[model samples]
Target: MDKLRQKDYFLFASAMYSQPISCSSLVEQATSPFVSFHQRLGCFHSDWHQHEWGQLIYAEKGCIHVNSRTKQILIPSGYGVWIPPDTDHEIRSTSSQTNIRSICFPVADNNGSLRQTISVFPMSTLLREMIRYTNRWNQGPVDEAQATTFLQTVQGLLPEEIDKAVIVYLPSTTHAKLLPITTYIQTHLARPINVQWLASEFGLSVRTLSRLFRQQLGTSFSGYCKIARIMRALELIELGCDNVSQVATDVGYESLATFSNNFLAICGHRPLQFIHSKRLY
Candidate 1:
């Protein structure tokens, strides 16, 4: 097996905003338990980076792709990606114009295990609104008890476990020759894509590509594609795509029956049923 490169295994981001003069920072600057909100423009690019304080990253208006050492998470609006402090991760906007709102908090104590991986959570509407309100309080000396109470309420709502569907972990190898192929498959899910073409484009043998997929993703290329398609379908359904047949076609499945079968197999329910339940919730 080929050895992984350090650069390939990690992402780097250079831009970060440290909070100023807030009680969260004032009281806890040494620990740096503070919250700040940001609006990122279309051209902004945050390379891979880590911080002393764990971060709660949420998107108020857009979506982002987050990659930790172990997995990659697609954080859309209403979802937040939690990074324990000192975990190496990268972030990029899915849309050209992306708007993000985030809260950075210091962990009560430095626990190395907590910083080991990315934990994604559903950002409930109430929690989102509360963060917005709390950010309004100036960073000067504030009532410690009230501030602590607000922080506790924020922490209390975080779910113990997050249900995530699509996550890609980077290998130690620096070879990203296969990444373009994966990116192509993700971006063109609605269209027909074949291994022969992918291999040809990358100047690699089909067998080599297959082996790479199995090694890097722990699944066959076809399986990865199906999972990716299902994830996209779920996102669309959540956004009010009620017609399952159309969604199936949109995600590159030729037959509606086949799409339904695959969707049921992966999601354990029919697409319509899933969407209906989501609506009820």
Candidate 2:
């Protein structure tokens, strides 16, 4: 993190750690075939755990970070992650004022492609509206015939919608040498980071460091840095950072046009458009 944002990030991290809530009551109940819960959170962390049922976690206002053993996915505002039953995972809030809506499903409730895997997908306008409508169920014992049928219709639409999954996941690694490097990159995204600088700072030769990133993280050093910058940029935008130029610099970009171009390439929307869309939610 840059010096300018250090205090803000510290507060975010501290608040996130200080406030943790359990979803056991809502997730473990057998009384409902599907249950939905909504809560507004101030950047918090839920340490590693697994649910007895599958969960679709949506962020209506901010961003969520979901981590499994293999990968870490970022669900930006207006997006959601579907985690399968019994899948060990951890969730962390990425922005203050994260409004989370989660719908839990029994093991037998789904049999399509959406079952059995963790997927981060975009929530279309129609799906977002439908999910908002379920606020009436409010952590439901949604066993009523009409309510169940409507929710079923929502569940039925998921498989098709998931085909539009966005690639917002950060590349992760377990290598002893690279783990700290990746973590540092995430925390210091505003710095001018490169393969040569990281190689020297970490006491590894340039060739070896470059090779490690490709072999272990499945991306080149520059590629991983690009992904990290764009992800941080999105999180900042979701947190209500409205100045395009300021956000560009906050993520280590020197050129506004360059930042905007990269943001469009990864997110399928320009930064300003993304900022405008956040207001709709």
Candidate 3:
């Protein structure tokens, strides 16, 4: 947290965004209670801040990670975070070319049903298209009638609760020794991962290393490695690295069939299907 930067206000659009519809236009849009920021971000993050408006911070390309003190939400491409008004959180981009679509709505637009905590929602074919359509809608100020219709459509499409978003419960501890090990697994996904091999390389007995993973992370070393590989693959895919065979090799699977099987098991979509279905460009 100490290493991160925070902005006083995240609701306003940054210069990085180049939407045909200017941010100012939306701010003054008639009865519309929402305004949005669409931009491609470099390697930067905002300080913890909250506003009277609830928000949805998303990445059209790459991944966006949102964290509160107790929880961390990974907004992998195709996923979005529904942050309630005034919820304290910090945001950072995992990639240099992270394209963000952040929307803010006054609390009144929540309809008294918005969840108090951060939650993930789906962008179905209809929902996804609506988002794009709305972002492009700049025909003068929106009236109360139009705003109500727009808001109703959005709320109807949103899920009642968080579904399958990748959320990890973070330990308050820095987990110094364990952190580097995970980083290695992510970076070296193309290589085989063996707990004994890692333990030996890191100068820890296999048993001690095993215990550390189980006790601190509540997951076995191999389990953690498996997830690390998949998460990395997801990132690469969202970043436009779409060749399944290439992705399989990059993520350490020698067999393409094996890779697809694991991908289906974890992501519920075959590698190629997932790649095509994503909103990535």
Candidate 4:
């Protein structure tokens, strides 16, 4: 196993120890056929870790943010993310009242085709109810014949459901100069954030800033802004800001029509459509 980063370790320790009994034991010593953890938490972050079993992380209320080295995925409320076994990643609760439900699947039980990549899938009523039922075995070997069989049925339904995954990953950067700029964009999503303005604020030339974004983040400033706004809109909707027009304005869009078009282009769903879908779960 790879060593945990220093900052990752500190954040993980702080969050895990706050629980009534350390849930760290559940994650680290997951020898059971299946294990699940359901907790209502405020803002939370986990340390870098990998499991021998594939993991399904769901947020019943807010949004779940899953970060890997290469990508950052936002799993909105009523949705879940599937992490393949042996994948290095960390999970975060992006909203204040996040209800996180995590279920682990042994290698033999997970979808073979999806065993190598992470995916975010919308949870159907059947699937969501099935996962919620598993809250029965939060600390578990879950090896009983009936329970194991039920879990296997859920595993079987995954590959088909995961095909409907909505890929909404916000751009991220670790470059020293770009990191602060990215952070600024996230906090100021309601502002008119342009490359020229950012360059002036960060004391870099516009050309230099554009080049840095292209090289490090593989996107233009405007491109990243669009992604950031839409992803933030998703988080807002998950947080109970259900007005489409309000969400559009909050994320820097002056026109509701434009916001709807961009939301559709990016995630193949209109803002209202996404909200309705979320309500179904």
| Candidate number with greatest TM-score | 2
lDDT of each: 0.61, 0.79, 0.64, 0.77
RMSD each, Å: 9.0, 2.7, 8.1, 7.3
lDDT of 3: 0.64
- CA deviation > 4 Å runs, candidate 3: 1-33, 40-44, 50-53, 67-76, 84-88, 94-98, 106-122, 136-139, 144-149, 164-173, 279-281
Best by lDDT: 2
- Candidate 3 lDDT over 50-164, as tens digits, reads 6666776656766776777655556666667788777777777646567777767665554666656777543455555556666654445557567657766676555443455
Error of 3 at 21 (Å): 19
lDDT of 3 at 158: 52
TM-score of each: 0.65, 0.88, 0.69, 0.81
User: Candidate 2 lDDT, tens digit per residue, 1-281?
Assistant: 66447645654665656567665645655465677777888677786788767788888877788888877888898887888788888887746678888877654554657566788777888888777777778643444787767867777777877777777777668899999999888888887887788889999999999899889988888888888888888877766678999899888999999999888887778989988877777
- TM match of model 2 to true structure: 0.88
TM-score pick, better of 2 and 4: 2
lDDT of 3 at 103: 67
| Rank ordering of all candidates by TM-score, starting from the highest | 2, 4, 3, 1
Model 4 residue 28 distance off true place after TM-score fit, in angstroms: 2.6
3 against 4, candidate with superior lDDT? 4
C-alpha positional error of residue 73 in candidate 3 after TM-score superposition, expressed in Å = 4.9
Question: What TM-score quantifies how close candidate 3 is to the native fold?
Answer: 0.69
What clash pairs does model 3 have? Answer: 5-47, 6-46, 6-47, 7-47, 30-141, 30-142
Q: Can you rank all candidates by lDDT, best first? A: 2, 4, 3, 1
